[model samples]
Target: RGGPTACEFSFVLETLGSKIAAHEGEYADSDCYEILSELALLGRYELRALKLELRLAIEGVRADKFELPYRIASERTGCGFLILPVTREFHDRAFNALQSLSLASKHELELERQVGIGMWKNSEFVDVEWIFLEGGNPPDPDLEGRLAFSYPFRRVSEQRLPPIFT
Candidate 1:
């Protein structure tokens, strides 16, 4: 009779499987790397919840410097030490997509303004950060008639875009 602990493991594995299947490209269909990633994350938290061991926190936030409540939370459920920092690798495809969006600034060479999205992977003692930049600036993080042109970075599954991170 493995109560809630076992049930939690079952649920986590199920979610891990689904999330794996959700990843697009050769990585999902052939490599299956996403599932392995999920397991690594879940295993971190599971150790904390079940074994009452040390743990860490994974956070994604928009560095707009004003709005606060819109941060993104990435979590794991076991082991707790290995903090995997996963994010959308904005190589070339990301920039081309941002270029198609409407711009709202004087710098004709730029998209919107600059909006920066970031992820922080923190464990009991370690922290790794990743940043994704779009647009360039929005005049300000506290204004109405404006959009940080480069925002809405095509929506990567585990991404939290700036000016509207989640």
Candidate 2:
């Protein structure tokens, strides 16, 4: 027999703020407009024109600020399924989770394949130019084509494992 609590209100505010700051008009056509409008009426949260101000502030921030590089992903080439890299801001936790699995010898291929599928599903910024497989020896040309694949995530290779400091 309970109604919405103070915590719920605070949660909504935090979520709205994140949505506002992370990407301005990302929610412009969504319910955020209505929620922000209603919340502005409360006058308790300093909501007076908050959404407009937020949109203006977010406009100053470029979209690239929200992008992350070298996300673990995969693709289906003429050669077959090849693990690769992609760039995006979301699904970071999923990428990190699968990357951890890829580090373990027992789970490398299986987990890498899963990460590739996850990227493939997103399909927003998938890259197939340079495929990254986890090993010193490259796969067969018939399996992965000589120029297509690269052995990344190694100490010697030009490619670097990330958590690349900003």
**Please, what is the whole-model Cα lDDT of each candidate in the order they appear?**
0.29, 0.31
Candidate 2's TM-score reads: 0.19
TM-scores for every predicted model: 0.22, 0.19
RMSD of 2: 18.4
User: lDDT per residue, candidate 2, 1-166, as tens digits?
Assistant: 1333434334335755665566675544333454344344333223222223233222222232331222222112111121222234434554553344233311323322221211312353321111222333334344333223543332211222232133
Q: How does model 1 score by TM-score?
A: 0.22
Query: In model 2, how large is the Cα lDDT of residue 55?
Result: 32
lDDT score at residue 140, model 2, on the 0-100 scale: 37
What's the distance in Å from true for residue 11, model 2?
A: 1.2
lDDT of 2: 0.31
Worst 10 residues of 2 by lDDT: 73-82
